[model samples]
Target: MQSVALLLIGIQLVYAGKHSLQYFYTATSGLPNLPQFVSVGIVDGQPFTYYDSKIRRMTPRQDWMAKSVGEDYWERNTQASIGSEQAFINNINVVKDRFNQTGGVHTYQEMYGCEWDDETEEINGFDEDGFDGGDFTTLDYKEKRYISPVPQGLATAEKWNRDGSLQQRKNYLGTICVEWLKKYLEYGKSSLQKKVSPQVSVLQKDPSSPVTCHATGFYPSGVTITWMKNGREHHEDVEVGELLPNEDGTFQKTSSITVTPDEWKKNEYSCVVEHQGKSVTEDEIRSNKGDSVPIGIIVGALGAVVLLIIIVVAGYKVYQKKKGFKPVNGSDDGSNSSAHTVPQA
Candidate 1:
């Protein structure tokens, strides 16, 4: 299981030779202070466009995206997102009816994407739907069919299969999607392909608390953090966290291990981070107090740095505004669709 976990992380993070384009759509019911519908476009793991029911507009999230397109593009995508908003709103209720629920917080989500391997020139596509955090249906691009894990999704699968949607999906994923992905890569090559190394630190709260190894501000979002004991891989009492995005499009992650102070005094323990063909280690944290900083102080310093970055970004945006820069926007086309039918009672 550990090896499998590492392999999956590698696949998600090691994108030096591969690229992907993905879009996520989400709708909810009975939730307050949140948009009823939201759509996001990501190219190679970085968000480039976004829309929400509250804003009712499609907006670019990156500078390249804004500069590469015109106002017409934003208008078209906004219209498309408005249509998707209604469809997804209806979809949430339809899914709720399938589950035999009348009210409460419920969610419906769709994720679709294509992957390109530069070295092999291989292309792959995926589409999936979920309800209340569980898999509802998925598209088998290879078989050109839909698979439903629960009975509730059978009707949707059947309808999609009979409606000539499979061929449409196949063609889009195989050709149109790939074409757009390539265009995006070319347009944003400098920002998308650049690499940034992480700043690693070992932190401890107190004598009895677990030790945490943190890596932040790394690009490409692919990193592995492991604990080593006596020069061997250590796994006991270890907790690995999910990858989280930073404000500047980089990523951060933490992995912690629990060990007694006595054990630390006796054995050699180190934190190893592997990213982008480079390895970083803080082997002296266990034995040297000078190297292992207190968690509270480190967090405070990080908070200050984050505030500084935010200020700098705000000033830069103001500068762009003074220079008469504007935001830009995507149309849904058939590429973005619900592609699901509600099950009948």
Candidate 2:
């Protein structure tokens, strides 16, 4: 019940009034301190969705998306397209059709968002930042929050909106974003394996001290920084920090604990960091924060039952040897034992 309530709260957050959804896919070739790939849809300040390159599909549309974009748009572009291989590829072309060739650190992003405007009927607006051979460009609707002057020497530039641009009519926009997302998912995490290890440090103010285990400049956001005492995770006096974005697009975090000088001298404390996998295929998963304990217990129980079945089947089997025969007229093999002689009242 608590989880369900929290889920409702979370869903309401993005759809409450109005919010923005920023879709991003990035790939890098040379940055040592950045994530190799990033495919995410950030709604307001939280993660609303992401692309799954492994399966070549966008995530399930939140309720907000259905209400905002209309159900048909959500199903056709995000669900149906990714469900079929050819349709998925066609969707990828939507991004490729607009993006420049990839090299070095390439980033592709789209801004399709909604807001509660009592004065304005809800209309989806889109903006995109794309990489070029040696430069970058922005394409967006006129109503977007950020609008820039077109390049000095561009032959043509196009900006489309549902009602604003006048030249291009926004049609099946959700479908277009899906394909653009596919393009981003293709290369965004190309540098995942090339991540730079965080610079970890334990700091204390005095000899007997509260120490801060600081980890900075690590790529791929879900890195876990843990403080261990004598090789075991310690939580009583430990503080694990959150991921802070570096100016360079990499990430940083810190975990802290307090200990006596004697404990410090004995080296009883250490910091361990677990870096997550990078690829989307065969490696991507949804992080369910509240259900871990119950799910683990359920899976463990099921495993024990399966192990019991294996134990029984692995035992030896006996052969009948043709010596087996039905006793003539139901006679026993000299071993008929009776514990009762009729039921005497």
Candidate 3:
């Protein structure tokens, strides 16, 4: 039995590391200032293409994406997004009516993507929809059906299933989506596969404030920031923040812990940041306030300044699917938002 369990564990490990390609679409109503429709294309958590109702054109966010694809690709995707914009606008209104919401700001979002495990070459896909900051429907790819979380989505789910859209979705998610993902990966391998170590720092306003451990300028997004007390893991009063994108295309995150000066003096508290298999920790900590300093160190005053400009452009794609807004650089039109493009699968 132990050998069988070990074999299972080993099998699971074969599919551990995965690369994903995803597209996010958001349609909004009742917000005159913001774009009514927005779409974004992402590969391995990096935004590559963006389109909004205001721009009315599909633009490449990454240099590799622009250099690899030609004008026809952009024209094709741009036209598709223009069509999807109208469709999604109708979808939002449909959802609003189903929910009996006559007015007020509402958003309808769709996210579909595929993931490929590098080691095992295993592929998996997902399609989900959200309405007004909540789940509406999700596709069960294995069963080839749509699952509705709310009563308002039941009709949409049944109609989609009855109209034979599931088979089309299944084909897209399994085959076409994976093919596009592979192509994108090939085009952007140099940038996508490159990993950069994070700059870790511990900061505090004064002896009374919570000590914050900030990790910034890391690539590939996956990271772990933890607090340790006396060499063991510390959990109490620790607040882990959301991952935010830096202007330089890297990612930043913060974890803070509240401890009294006396408690910190009595115990050895340290912040550890693990990114891309590298661990960073500082031992000497100093504060702006003239208090008895801790043994650990504080670094990156410059990073703290950069953090002030760090705006959360992309939403938590998996967690809070409603907030899918990203601003493109060098846009004078004052219209920055999120959107999507529909590819025939």
Q: lDDT per prediction? A: 0.62, 0.33, 0.64
- For model 2, name the residue pairs that clash: 18-115, 18-116, 26-188, 36-189, 36-191, 37-188, 37-189, 91-179
lDDT, candidate 2, equals 0.33
Report the Cα RMSD per candidate.
10.6, 27.6, 10.7
Candidate 2 worst ten-residue window by lDDT: 307-316
Tell me the deviation in Å of residue 96 in model 3. 0.3
Score candidate 3 by TM-score against the native.
0.80
Error of 3 at 6 (Å): 42
Tens-digit lDDT string for candidate 2 (1-345):
111111111111222223232333333334456433334444333343444334344453333332333334333334422333232233233434344433354332222322222234344444333332222223344443233343521322333222243222132232332233222223232432234445544455555546665656554433555565665657877776644556554556677676666555565554555453222211121222121111111112221101110000000011110000000010122121100010000
Which parts of model 3 are misplaced by more than 4 Å?
A: 1-16, 277-317, 322-345
RMSD (CA, angstroms), candidate 2? 27.6
Output the better candidate (1/3) by lDDT: 3
Candidate 1 lDDT over 1-345, as tens digits, reads 121121112124334577877666677788787777777666777777777888898888899988877776777677777777777788778778888978888777766667888789988877667777677777787888988889887887787777766666676667766777787787788998777767777777776788888878877666777777876778999999866677788878899989887787777776666566233333312322343322221112211111111100001111101110011122233233212222221
> How high is each candidate's TM-score?
0.78, 0.31, 0.80
Q: Candidate 1 clashing pairs?
A: none
The clash count of every prediction, one per candidate, is: 0, 8, 14
